[model samples]
Target: MKATPITLLVCALGGEGGGVLTEWLVEAARLAGFPAQATSIPGVAQRTGATTYYIELFPVLQSQLCGRQPVFSLSPVPGALDALVSSELLETARQIGNGMTSPERTRVLTSSARLLTTQERMQMSDGRRDPAELLKLVRAFSREHQVFDMNAVARECGTVVSAVLLGAIAGSGLFPIERRFYEEAVRGGVPHEKANASAQASLRGFAKAFEIVSQRQTQADFVSQVLKAQAMDSRLRGNDAGADGNDGRATALSVIPAEAGIHGFPPPVREFASLGYVRLADYQGRSYADLYTRRLRQVLDAETAADPQAANGHAITRETARWLALWMAFDDIVRVADLKSRASRHDRVLREVKAGEDDLVKVFDHFKPGVPEFAALLPSSLAQKLVAWDRRRIAAGKEPWAMPLKIGTHTAAGMLALRTLAAMKALRPRGSRFAFEQKMIERWLDGVVQGTKRGWALGHEVAHCGRLIKGYGATNERGKDNLLHVLDHLAVLPETEAATHAIAEARAAALADDAGQALDATLVRHGAPKREPKPQPIRFMRRPVPRESMDERRA
Candidate 1:
């Protein structure tokens, strides 16, 4: 029988340089005098799916083929891959789910990093897939696996993730090609002028990945070593945690700086409360943070009175702590401007683009604020008139009024504008949106407290309803409506397992779909009235007759 070619598959999202990595692998194979072939299937878009590159290399050198060319497959067959490399955790699980991996054959190399998929982002609640489950899937299917944060390594080396992936593949020893061929391939792939610098950065990423994969036998051990190496290297560069007065450790919640003034709550509730306290403090001020804690304490007391034994471990209060903080810090133009103009944000942009310290980077922030955004900050009477006027315009088939702004955040003028807008946070409390949000928050909080008095499960379900109150503008408004509907219809129902289950189902339905159709169905099933549909503009447009039809009519 003819010698079989070794099959390898690479999976990466758009702009992560999957194509460059594929070219490098093929070029390395060529440099090693091995006959290689490669093919790729492009994915729909970034995060929807990963583009997969399939390669087949005749294990034997071309010089030894005696002019007999071995055939290669354009795509990988299920359970036949020798190696599978992926840049994302979920995409790795996706490949395994396709039955492309085998315990006896495939060596999987994947990054622990995740880019949330469109499906994950669409859910109203926490829609992320469990990383642990994805990792378990990877481990169960592969003969061997080396999983680490390739994106982190790339950032550290100031190179693309493709370099790190190439290094990991080289270190895995799946290919018969030597390491030098791979290095030469990376160098050859780039152009001149900054070739040496580019090659150095790529090599740094390659070496870091190569060392991590080659030295450690397990993922945990590899990660530990990598962290230790980072620590040591940072110390050498005089940038250690001591230099910044932070060890980058969070082994215990009590050690968190946010724990200040959050003393009386139970452990579970305290953890979330501490985080919430810190977030609210940053979003508004210490007084606003105090207000959040005070509200949380009220829920805790209610939960404690209901379940003195702490059987549920303050589950209601814990959930409330998280969602309450987020609700209180509702996004406004001020928040956006503050975030855009922050020094840390500028530094993060520079780092993400791999800009050197001396590199000049220009950052522009685009915004389109409609009448509604402006009306949010106006007094109630004025805001109502403004919004009504805009609605009237929409009803008249005219587009609602909005101003599109493009600000160069890197320039002095842009910085001034953003800071000036950010300074308007002092005026946020007097705004119509703030008053409306506070009223809704009070309603939700009251439901949580009263539901706890009724039953623990009922209270917990009510607490989870807080998740529906998220996003901004119409999405935010829809979430609040859904939450209020649940509070009014379900929270008042007699405390029972059935009532609690109905509340849970309602919340799930609301999160499952954005249009609220599923939620309406659930509400009707539970004997609650479905939401009243809002009035929609019914405009009839006049269809123009075709020229041929008009001419025939004239004739």
Candidate 2:
């Protein structure tokens, strides 16, 4: 017999073992030799709290050819579910609206409404609706509905209702798994025999209920069987088509947005799609050049779309094109042997100078002669040295005057030096000169990293640090206020030094306060130390009598 595809949705409160039920089905399907895929939204509201889980299963036939198959989420296609097993009634209603179930092809096994409602909580703080009312709603949507007091069954069996619900889903006769699959699942999940016994009892009860429903001809077995078969055949064909290279397989692209921890600017849609999900893991370790190229491609695409007078008439704007070309050319020169190192060395020197080191002047003097005349014109101490040298030459009658030169600020020079170091690091691989050049071009295409007008920059350490400090305040009111005082004092110190000294001060203050409080408590418990006056020192007056005796003897 041909196999069928079945989608089973298990919905419950996030902490109420919904995930456990889904896992049981997955294991059962696997043991039954059925092909299956499961996806879930595991938490509430992105990152807030708890969330629901959704599972879908597909049974494969023995006669089918083996090949790759597409994995789909719960809501991949509409009206594709064969069974809807919900832990709560409201969730059943939600699944129906989300296209997770079809009235003609789905079997719904749900608990009656014992869970608290939003309105009940708002009004009474402990309101609950009749379980029978919830069952009525399920019956209205499902042609084959089985309502059981699984909560009571669970209590009698000495277990929770979740395992009982899983047993009920197994007994629904939707999956091709054997009885042992459910038994083993219960054994693995519940651990205790009493819980397993509860699940078995629930299964037996659901089986009896299903038998009565089946006898009435109320079950839409024929429709469900047909749909399941059609779904299986489609999967088999899709696998075969993918194997034959006639139909493209579903590409799983994982997008790591710029905001998602990546350091570079956001790339254009086309470039973003090119890298796809394959290189997502490489985002962290990628070379600056590679990141730049990827970003440049995006910018170029955007510029091309917005421009009007290119060779393609709609190609990149002339200004952007020129800028990109100039950047690439500069990148080529910058990639020369030791250029990156030279630049890094320059940056290091500047950093040392900023930190109050005066030796950087010596390093600057060594590289000054080779540096461009434009770079020679700076307010740096080295520039002063160059001016002095020119004046000396003119006095010696070798030169008439100093030549005009342009230079960069200490910060700009430092940036240039860092870029050089990055370039040198890229050149370590042999036979990669051209590749390095291409990467340089790409990096140049991406714009410079700069702070915003308000001095806030995306992904800046200071910005994140500020946010952390603010969040600490919101975390706890009184404790945070004390900490804030310490932080304020620390902020006045240098950024580099504040972290260590401020932390030490805050800790010392807290410890001292704790010690003083402990002492006060000790005094309150055992009484204060006995009061006593300190003795005064005696004063000597024999000096005056000795001097008078010496004066009388002299007279």
Candidate 3:
């Protein structure tokens, strides 16, 4: 028996069963005849923090202690935790940042899944902190680390994340407690009313997680052996390739698989283009995907001609492939309906709500599409008139038209309504919004090609401006307007280095401010006119006079 207790810490968000997991662990230890203690530090409501559980279990069994009680600490000491487990990636990084982990001692087990923080959600653009950075921190700070998507596993097994986490901890081999004890604790912890079903689901989740972690550990050991053998062979041959050789091998393994419909493009461009092709094909049809490939080829050809040596690795074409595909698959009423009507979406809802096989669950979806949404599906001529009419009504202080719908998707009528709307994909090509989007896409593509012919950097910056075209409704319109403003004033013919920097700056500014104020300031600073604002009609309103004041005046 070891002299000291095994120190462990658990970090989990609300509703993920952090407290329950701690209870199971403590119970498992006690069942194993080990003296165990646990304490918790609760976090604030919402995402302000994650509740943390600290545990200590005496390494020696009570039978071996010979009437002596092993003392346990109420909380973890920094650099002393034998294991650190977390349910969220960012929270794992956060705990590491607080000096609780040690490269020489801590073994980290974390979920790769993300629950975006308030700061990330509040950003005007994609504000996600790169998961790669968080993973890197975990690797650098921990003696060993294992990461996989626990949320996905939990959903697949029809259980909460706690079960999967418990499985991982057991499979990690950090403690002397056996797997059966953990299983026993799990079964013991369930309520008698729904014990059979809930226990089966949790046990399934636990077993799945255990299998995955055990397999990963085996694979890591095998890989280490092979890499060592190869290194030894190289050393015997007097060739010490070291880190560079390993890196090259890793890069080779990471090569992107060729996607269909982009076989004609060069490998680098084909990587992104293939993904775009598949996306557009799913969004519209094979013919639409074919169009995407052809357009991508235009940029690729121009970039290849300009930078024959492949200095930038065909970056402009790759960027265009990604952004063009996303732009073409713009969100509209039809797209929304298509997504909502998918079988996978319904399945996801069922899993999220934790419905059992015998349980009957009803799903309801609500929508309130206004005038502009309806106008998007009409012919260009009619759509324009409808939009103008709605604008005038708004200008006259009248509420614009809207249709509010409550769809019980579990019902046949509701499902039919959504599917019928989704079936309107064929009409998208003929719609006003489609025509307008295609025209803008062509213009943007032209700028990319023209800019590439002039300079590589300028073309890359122009392609990046596509980031502005996102979301729907006013946000979408604002993005398009911002992109056009940059293209018109900044995408000068015979592009200069200064113009390239200006375009980059303008793109950054556009993403930084949703209202386009920062973008306009950037353009003006770069010697261009600010984007012109659309005129809004002013309306006068009469304020209501208080009844007592009116009576006093009358007296």
Strongest candidate by TM-score: 3
Q: How much does each candidate deviate from the true structure in C-alpha RMSD? A: 8.4, 31.3, 3.5
lDDT per residue, candidate 3, 248-355, as tens digits?
354445577677788877777777787888889999999999999889889988898889998888889888988999999998999999999999999888878888
Residue 32 error, candidate 2, Å? 1.5
TM-scores for every predicted model: 0.83, 0.34, 0.92
Per-candidate local distance difference test: 0.89, 0.47, 0.89
Which parts of model 2 are misplaced by more than 4 Å? 1-4, 43-50, 61-64, 67-71, 74-78, 124-133, 189-555
| TM-score of decoy 2 | 0.34
- Candidate 1 versus truth, CA RMSD in Å, comes to 8.4
lDDT of 1 at 434: 88
